[model samples]
Target chain A: MGRIKTTNNQISRREIIIEKAATLFKEKGFKAASMREIADVVGVEAASLYNHIKSKNELLNIICFDVANRYTHKMEEVEASKLTTLAKVESLLRFHIDGMVNHFEEVYVSDREWKHLDNPYLSNMQNQRRTYRKRFAAIIEEGIKKKEVKKIDAATAVLIMLHAIGGIESWHRSTRKIIGKELEENMVTFLIDGLRKI
Target chain B: MGRIKTTNNQISRREIIIEKAATLFKEKGFKAASMREIADVVGVEAASLYNHIKSKNELLNIICFDVANRYTHKMEEVEASKLTTLAKVESLLRFHIDGMVNHFEEVYVSDREWKHLDNPYLSNMQNQRRTYRKRFAAIIEEGIKKKEVKKIDAATAVLIMLHAIGGIESWHRSTRKIIGKELEENMVTFLIDGLRKI
Candidate 1:
């Protein structure tokens, strides 16, 4: 167990550990990725990996909750902003598409790998997600109330918004026929444009 | 394989084999679900399974291509019809959603499990899928030219439509807060209404 730590890094060692583990989990899936491989990738000895994080499940827990919190925070900011419903939605769509592509490792793990999390974390994670989605749906409802948006069902809109961006997962392995910025712009326009009448 | 054949069953025994395999594939996934297991549920002797079908790969190939062909044919029929572009797109939306929810096993394996297929079948399947998406996108472009649909990028619209219904996969396991008919109606409305000026 080699355990010399760097004191100069700005981010906490724990955050770096979670980040690396997110990449591993994104590549190999949560069940298939091992603590040893994560440590190896993170520049730590396998045995001393425990010194930084308690267990693999803890890392999954942190990644899942952390991503959910970030999304909720972003959603809160957009919702609380004075931007028109369309702009708020465009912001939220960009955030999701951005996470799916640019922050591929952490957000992908958060979206797809959180099922492996244990206990209260699992239930809690799902609840947090459910809450976030309902709150998102509420944003659409608010739009309809303001008469800026089409009268489409909010629940259905949220479903489209969430899963629609999931298509980008394939784009990561695709030929990159469309660059990231173009895909992001086109995708956000496709969704936000769908929200309004005329 | 059973040798004792009714000879007059409306759907062929081969169709039955494919149907059962689709169920098993949906439950256990194409990789985890075995031929022996498929035969057992299919009420055929394990050894005679190959007499009815070539291999698991053949079953996957059949399922994937069959679903894609069905979607393509539907698209062609709708495209050639005299329906308005909005109606044509709505019909296509309904077909995809109907396949996703009602034909859950075949559509899901077709959409998700095709990658397990090998060689020419793999390349062929990809080509078929790409053609379908492009044709679908062209439908949007047609609508745009007539000004019945908004001028959002057809490629992006196609992406949203295809991946949006994929969200219904999770609804299979969710509590049936929404019935299949209602969901189909609302989901179709959500996508099709997004297409045009009020």
Candidate 2:
């Protein structure tokens, strides 16, 4: 019982560090923000931070991988929907936008601190994203075959959609300038109309 | 005459550092690549590098600002064209694509290292990009009014298309299955077709 309690406490403390570091890293960047600064914010000595993680790079890697995996998992849910190919694309785009809005900090950290991960870890994260992209492309391919979507390049169509979705983190703050629901509705319609055959 | 020769040499050396640093930043990222490494590649000591620039972050700021400025300049030219709105959008997408393909390294570094720049510098770049995005939205706004584009939220339409264009740098590689020209052509078709009124 004591051992379990101790482990739980350790995990909690580590998470505290990650939360604090994530905010700083998002604001100042991974290279510019130092370990001492992170420890200072975490209310621990710089050396104590080493006890929870091997290095600053490892901490950054954990945060990035965690966020990316969350996005991948959310995308998986979209992939499982019973919608048509075009609808699935729209749903997936919304899911991506919602994810960015809800988890802006995590997504921001993942993108900015991606380089801190070691080679194998970085490659794994990259592959996960690529696989997610391929899943989108597969949906486009299905739409093309069904003649629901114009016979455009499936890869290109999917990539274009992904780009639009992925970039929401950079610009979503100003979404209120137009009614959010109205803007989203129009975006969906515009995308669908663009994909349909004339 | 001696002063003129020294000034030219300084300019030449500064160019060499920027060129080499851009390449290194692309391969290893801005954080991982250091002042010493940049200097070594330029055949100078680490201290000598400071003579050419204020700091590493300043180098990054210069490169990124130039990209934002160049992109805005291209948009200005595209705006002046007498082509149809659809054609103009296609031209804009292609122009942005050409910028990415030709200066992939520089663009990639600028985008990824944006946080390194101080607030004023970063804000300037951000506003410049916002102005550029406004140009795209204005095009869409005009198109909608002219019945060239379907009635939609002009801002969202522009945002989606711009995201699709900018995201090209993340995935465009020589080894990719699609060739550059074909990809650009398909993208143009997708954007125009997606926006056209039925």
Candidate 3:
């Protein structure tokens, strides 16, 4: 029972570290944030932080890949769904909006700090990103072929949708008077409606 | 004659420094890049750089404000024009696209690095940004009133357009097989066409 408790404690501690690290990375950027600062924020000694996590780079890798994997997994589910192209895009946009809203710090760090990722991991993230974009564009292309979506450049359309959703980050910094649901619906109306054939 | 030649040399040298600083800031981010490195890129001694520019933060301020001023000035022109709301938006989109392509480094630095500006400058830039968004949204509101645009949340639509244009930075990282004109036209279609009242 003690051993099991220890393992559970370790898992939660690691999560706490990642949460703190995400905030730091988002505020100070990955290159400028230090492990000591992360440890301080997590309420642990810098030395003990090494016991829970390997290094600052490891923290970045975990944050970046975790978010990337979430996106990839969401896209996979989106691909398998029986929804129409427009519905699929809306679903994807909702997922992105939720991620940005609920997980703003993590999502922002993943989006901006992914560039600081080192080798193997960097390439892996890039491949995952490229594949995700291709899959997204494919959905638009399918929509175009079926006359569900307007005749638009699939890649450009995909870029606009994904990037526009990222604008939620800016909204977070704004007055934020618009509630989350309203913002999501308005964005969906703007983006998905734009994609639909006239 | 010597004084006039010296003035021209100073102006050109300052331009070169800004050009090189934009590249460094884009590559290494504002906080991580150094003025000395920028001087090295421009083949000037680090001290000589001070002669041309005040400091690294000043360079960032210059790059960021220059881009912001351009956007504000363009909007001023659009506001004064007799063009329909949709045409005004299209014109603004084209300007944004061209800036992202031609002055890619400067525009990018402006978008991402503006946060590093000090107090008054930071607040000043933020005010300009807010004003710009308000003006853009007001244009859309006018469109909705005149039945020129769909009855969507003007703020949300403006956010989509600006954020979508920022996505071109991602395209610059990709294969970039899509030429500038095609990308611009496609984006204009997806965004502006969606705005047109059905």
Candidate 4:
């Protein structure tokens, strides 16, 4: 019971660090955001921060890979579902927008600051990203083959959907007159409708 | 004749500095890139860089505003043209893709690095950007009224187009498999076809 309590404390403490780090990373960028600053935000001594994480890069790796893993895992579930290609595309678009809305800092940092990651990890992240995109394009290819989607280039379509959803980063900063549900619906109509065969 | 030669030399020298600065800014980011490093790339002494530009911020301003002016000017021409609304959108899309292909570094730096500009200039650039987007949206609005465009929200449509095109930066780094013209045509079909009234 004592060990369980200690483990729970450790997990929550780590979560706090990551939550603070994401904000700093998003605001100042990964290169400019310091671990000490993150610790300060978390109300922990800089020295204590090392007890939970090894280095700044480790914190970054946790945030980036955490977001990447969520995406990949979601895609796997999506692939396993019985939904039609158009429905699957809608699911994916909803997932992307919901991720941006709920975890704006983590998603934004993962999208923008992944470049600051170092060697082996950087290449590994890139591989994961490329694989994810390939799988996404494969879905579009399937749609085209099944006559569900138009004959447009699958890679280009995937790029359009992904990047267009990423534009929600601006919406997050704007007056946001368009609420989240409306934005998602508009985007889905704009993208999925664009992919549908005439 | 002497005065004309001096003016030409000044213009060419300034162009060289801005070109080199754009490359460096794109690589290292505006804040991280040094004027000395930029001067190094231009084969000039660090001190001599100031003879051509007042500061690094000035260099960034020139690159950003130059691209913005090109875009705003092109939009003005498109607005004044006799083309249908669909044709105007096609022209705008073509202009955006062509700018990315031809002036990749400048456009990338302007899009990514303009946030680093100091105040007055920052707000000024923001206003210019907002105005540009409003104008773009106005074109779409006109299209919808004339039944040239589907009744999608014009702001969302503009966001989709611009951000989708920005994803070409990834293509610029990736394998050269999809050539520029093909990419533009594919994108045009994907975006414009979606916007056409059924």
Candidate 5:
């Protein structure tokens, strides 16, 4: 693999530390992975890491908040598309599916080990997650009102759909399992049938 | 609520410590919750807790293994039910849902914090989970053979179903945000519909 060479005089050190720490946290988990290890991974002494970040908790917040921000921003773009609620969900599912495929490690770090975040970061991430859930819920609620979907709890339906999509990162083998368009088609159809009124 | 107490001498001090520790571990998560806090919750000195369990990690092993054993054993019983594949999945879903509702603490403790388990325990639990998933996969495979279920990857189908049911612990809240039964019925219909050939 190519070494992650930080620009000597351009990019901020805090940004570098956050980027390197995200990879470490993803590999070893938030608790089991140490600040010292992250520092080493970033090509710096342990003490030097504190110059850019206050603690391990801060790094977690940065990475999680960063991902959550980007994910919701991506959703905003999707929501703007002239797509039906069903189509919006399909595109959203595809975005998440592709995102997990490309960023599988980050997904694991954020989801499985979120308990490591300190109070402020934890609360912020939780609120962001609630917002993300509400986006899909709102779409489902609209569909139900329009009689486009069967009567169902919009929140629960969205939760189930999102979890099923999120689960692909954990369960997909990539090497042994099918992939590309076929896999996407199968996942979309399965999710749609599960959510659609018909 | 009435305290879980007993007059029987068969429940040793060690068991009490483990039970209390499991409750704390589930509520606060394995890594964040402390051993000293566990001792305080159990009304014993932290040092005294060592007499019953060697380390915090060991205590986690005991709780995880215990729940994994229970979940796997119950999964086997569900697999043995004399019903069609869809009915069997419904039974499996009911078992996990009811168990989570009744033993909410134990299931929560074992599931959300599974990453804390080390070598043997982690591998053992992983195996147990794979077996649990395989039970559903087998049912899907059987359905496919009988031409009742559409052709699909048994493992993926099983994963979708598991996500649908296991996700309840995280998503369910008593508030009027969602009517729980409607959600469950939608899940059942959604899954069954997805597996039906067009």
Candidate 6:
């Protein structure tokens, strides 16, 4: 969420606060992160911090919904494309991997801290995730129908893909052997390629 | 852990307490699952639970390390076998899937609730997990060397496998479309079968 102001590509103070808070939230959990702490990191008074955001909970909402919205938006683009079922799945997988690797802070925090999200937000987040997975499963189902992919359980395939992406969190923490593009390439090859090649 | 007694194969009261504890732990978390709750579930007085086990920590230790030990022992047995690399990987995957499917309470509680374990146990548990993943990666490496598996990053392959297995928790919670052996078989076909076939 760049939220750029003008053609010069200036990010607002709000974006800066969000970025720094994502890091802090990743280090200390949502429950532990404070407005004073966020204010300190953003070089503003705790009072000033509230001018841009309402509360710690609001930061979480922004972070969580931002990541979810980005994925949903991307899924729309991928699904609408004229790409084949295999390409569609690979494109979506790359999007998830890219988010995990580069946008590590927001993506990781969003995935883990969603449990702390409030009712309407939490319920909405769950629905978004459910819808996203269903749409993903549908792509594989289409592949199976067109005889372009293996006749396997599509929902299971989606489950494997999503959780495999989640594995990148451990990948982030571990002594990583591959970085960025290579990791993305390798996973795409390992996952969706099977749906079509076999 | 069947720990079946002689002949008739009866599980002891201690075993019943452990089983009941696992379910309570899974439901209410290790912290929330008090001695009183475990006793209530087992139909014993809270005082009686202490006779069989020292504390909640022991129960967590039993659940976490028990699962760890079972996997380690199984890993040893599978490693000792003269099976081919592909077969060995398939064997391990089936072992994990079996654990996730059949032993949901113990396995689920163990995986999620290990964080509440004390220092030595936490450190030791981390080591066991690290070693297990390394060993799993080694098998994939061996498969690659033997030209039985694709030339992919072995460590990443292990990451994917383990996290994919973690996905089974969601499978347990979701409206499951497939059951035990079918889930295991589908996963095996999706995972290790690629190593040789490709």
The sequence of per-residue lDDT tens digits that candidate 6 reaches over residues A64-115 is 9999999999999998899988889888888999999989999988976786
lDDT of each: 0.79, 0.74, 0.85, 0.83, 0.71, 0.80
* Candidate 4 structure quality by residue, lDDT tens digits, B1-198: 111122444467778888889998887777668878987778777888788788888998888989999998998999999998888888998999999988999999998778878788889899988888899989988888888777777888788889899988878877846999999998988887652224
- Which 10 successive residues of model 4 chain A have the least lDDT summed? A1-10
What DockQ class does candidate 4 belong to?
acceptable
Q: Write the per-residue lDDT of candidate 2 for residues B1-198, one digit (tens) a residue.
A: 111122444467677788889988877778779999998777778888888899988889878988888888888888888988877877777887777777887887876677667789978877887778788889877877788777777777777777777667656642466777887877877776762224
Q: lDDT tens string, model 6, B100-149? A: 99999999888777866888999999899889988988887887887777
Q: List the residue pairs that clash in candidate 1.
A: none
Q: What is the DockQ of each candidate?
A: 0.30, 0.45, 0.44, 0.38, 0.36, 0.26
Ranking by TM-score: 3, 4, 5, 2, 6, 1
> Which residue pairs collide, candidate 3?
none
Candidate 5 chain B, which ten residues in sequence have the lowest lDDT sum?
Answer: B189-198
Provide the DockQ value for model 4. 0.38
Per-residue C-alpha lDDT of model 1 across residues A1-198, encoded as one tens digit per residue: 444454587877777788888888877667667888988887877777788778889999888887899898998798779997777788888889888878888888887667678888989988888888888888888888888787776777788879899888767766636888888887876666562225
Candidate 5 Cα errors over 4 Å, as ranges: A1-20, A172-175, A195-198, B1-16, B172-174, B177-183, B194-198
Under CAPRI classification, how is model 3 graded? acceptable
Clashes of each: 0, 1, 0, 0, 0, 0
What does the lDDT come to for candidate 6?
0.80
Q: What does candidate 1's lDDT look like per residue over B164-195, in tens digits?
A: 99988767766646788888887777676552
Question: For candidate 4, lDDT tens digit of each residue in A1-198?
Answer: 111122444467777788889999888878778777987777767778888888889888999999999999999999999998888888999999999988999999998888778888899999999999899989888988888887888887888889998888778877846888988888888876652225
* Model 6, runs deviating above 4 Å: A1-57, A193-198, B1-21, B24-57, B193-198
Q: TM-score of the candidate numbered 5?
A: 0.85
- lDDT per residue as tens, model 5, B39-145: 78877667877777789999888777777888778777877777877677677776666666566667777866676788887888877887777776888788778
Report model 4's TM-score to 2 decimal places.
Answer: 0.87
* Chain B TM-score by candidate, in order shown: 0.87, 0.82, 0.89, 0.88, 0.78, 0.86
Better of 2 and 5 by lDDT: 2
Please, what is the TM-score per model?
0.74, 0.82, 0.90, 0.87, 0.85, 0.81
Candidate achieving higher lDDT, 1 or 2: 1
Candidate 2 ranges beyond 4 A from true positions: A1-13, A40-54, A74-82, A175-183, A195-198, B1-13, B50-54, B195-198
